[model samples]
Target: MCNEVWLTSPNSNTYAQENDDHDAKSRVFCTKEDCEETFGMFLVKETMYLPERSYSELIRSSDTIRNARFKSVNWLITAHKRMNLWAATVFLAVNYLDRFISIARCRDWKSWMFDLLSVACLSIASKFNETNGHSLHDFQVDFVDTCFAPTLIQSMELTVLKTLAWRINSITPFSYIHILAQSVDDLTKRATELLLCVVLDHEFLEFKQCVVAMSAVRCALDQCVIKTSTKNVTFGHLETFIPQDQKDGMIECRRIMAKVIARDREILIRGKKSPATALKVDLYDFRNFSADDDSFLRTPEINVGSGKKRKREEE
Candidate 1:
């Protein structure tokens, strides 16, 4: 399956044109009926292993990560140039790691840890450069009573340092902080994040679909944000343009930010958007060959051992 579905070079116009006829033929006939039947049988065999939910519900549930308000606040700070990209990336990485680990170990989601990690990583990275010179002790004191114990706090600090080292070694020093800051809408922000993720790690093939989907969503958000922000339109004032029925759709746009991230991961791993089937054939022809001539033609073979061979020769 991997060999059959490996990533190929982006399609060229010539290849697309060549496939146009084949695509039309596929649409006109059940070219893959056997493959489809086999897949259906396999699916039936694996029905017990399948998760019980509509794809939409699974997608929506994945979007719950966007409800994470700390991301919004972090965006705000990074937008202002108050935080460096390295700091921002490290902050986010540390926060995500802590959350993932905590969830796995404790089965609890600590939302506040995100805020604390953002602030702490930013402070530490700033101080390391001797530019900001912020007091680390103050940060420790502020979060002391929170979920972080002294030992856990030390571990978090070490984790931040290790992550920073890994990032610095792996990624170029060019900062994406400005691009992210200028993204005035959630879609734009999400798209920027996905793009940055890909840029930071090209091996993250799972993000390709999310990045494409977010690109569309971000463009929509860009239009809305520009209109609203530039025109100074408030929620109350938006009633003039936004209808009540459409309001739900507009709100759902934000949800797409989360959904794209979640759905992209799931799709890349488990789901197949379309069938993995194609018409395959091999052509064969029997032809006469004359040693003295370059051209060949189809002809019945004469068995030299049989009397019919002499008869045909005489004929």
Candidate 2:
């Protein structure tokens, strides 16, 4: 075929484009049949990428770490929305950030370190989710006071990749949503939005990605967007995809998702500001402090013109 063919890989939910020669350098894609046959394997394999501890557990010991985690998540979310990238990108970026934080145990981490790490995670995520994503510098240009050089960002990216053993093909809630969507009608749009809402809140971190996906689907079904005669049957089939131990959490998660959806509705009716608005920070206010903060590094230079930036010694 001379034209472009867009195909969804069965192993993952992300799309891949194949040119006429079937070589557009896209992610390796499998057909729908492959997804169905190996869907069970995906469920079993998702646990490998999940964080050992929930977000709450990871930050329980330090208030500073808690604040940094919250702020980093918001920054990632804001950047994703600003860039108009896929929701999965931000979710994956946060997943990478959380996993790194959990394993690295960087209790002495500074705000600027989180900023740079967030950039690196987002850069990696954009590549995962977008076919024609922004450049590395494009991601750094929006940082507070410092623009990280390409090499610095690449170094951080490599650190993250190695930390996770190069397992960047994470199975997020979106992945399960993409898979389960095959069984039901119209599960993509609303379910995905609900999943995005859930991702923004750290509470969902405790639940498995499959559970979260099911909860999002149940929530979407409740929204009455999709008409189905065997809703319970559909749910039963979806339930089978989750592990036995996670089933209980799925019920509780669905309840929490209900509250979240209701709260979202109330915000719309009351015309209140979004939670995202509250999460926005005064980048300028912290710029000076972060610029001088050597906690994360000797410090990358402020220049964005070159690949390599000079590292200034601690004064």
Candidate 3:
């Protein structure tokens, strides 16, 4: 019941200047390979497993995937747009979906189940990531599926929350993507989209987020097919930024991602048909939106809890 800064707060004290300064200093000589190695070390404990729920049906093997597709990507991205969520939030939600399925051992998934999970994952991820996220009611407005009631979605959100073990503060490729994108600011958007696509498949889960991001950039560059070399900067130019030891892995990452892209190509095409270009989502919709009275869906804020408050609290 104490005063807390909502995660929605851009000025949340959780992100103090000290952390930023430390991160800035740490990345001075941090190559993508170093980032990948570091992430890979910790990724063993938690991360999205492969055969991504978005296109799980299409993938038969690491390299072999059917030409079919799923809207799990498009629907979630559209929801991301509609909810005015952070790009990272969408990725985290997808990661959550994959992880939840892996941990819960829930197979024999129904088609509509994917849609329901999409909504539930969106709500849960947004709540943890953005402080105040959309309610079941708000999501239904955009999704327009009445079969799964708001309460039902709320229940599913709890199930997802439990399945994730309340560890929603996941480390994603975006953690390193922002820093790497700085070197190639012009291609951030395109690179980020490619990163999203690659992560949708479980195949890339074995690799660290940093690796996926690097390979994604390669894939993005391949698609763009940029040839000009200003400052010797062409597509996949960042490959040099990786450590020599990890170079082969990076090369292979790019290769596997290529197949992931090929399999999801048609799905990606279909996903584009959604109203991705719609107007900006009005976040105020959730200002008073709640699934029920005293719902966990309505978190107070993204407070930087005092270290004294808990054994692991960073404050």
Best by lDDT: 2
TM-score of 3: 0.58
Give the TM-score comparing model 2 with the true structure, all chains together. Answer: 0.71
List, residue by residue over 6-47, the lDDT tens digit for candidate 1. 122223553454344223312322224432332233223222
Arranged by TM-score, best first: 2, 3, 1
- Whole-model lDDT values for every prediction: 0.31, 0.62, 0.53
Of 2 and 3, which scores higher on TM-score? 2
Give the per-residue Cα lDDT of candidate 3 at 75: 60
Model 2, global lDDT = 0.62
RMSD per candidate (Å) reads 27.6, 9.9, 9.9
Q: Evaluate residue 238 in candidate 2 and report its C-alpha lDDT on the 0 to 100 scale.
A: 44
TM for every model, in the order presented, reads: 0.28, 0.71, 0.58
**Residue ranges of candidate 1 with Cα displaced over 4 Å:** 1-120, 124-130, 137-155, 163-165, 168-255, 258-315
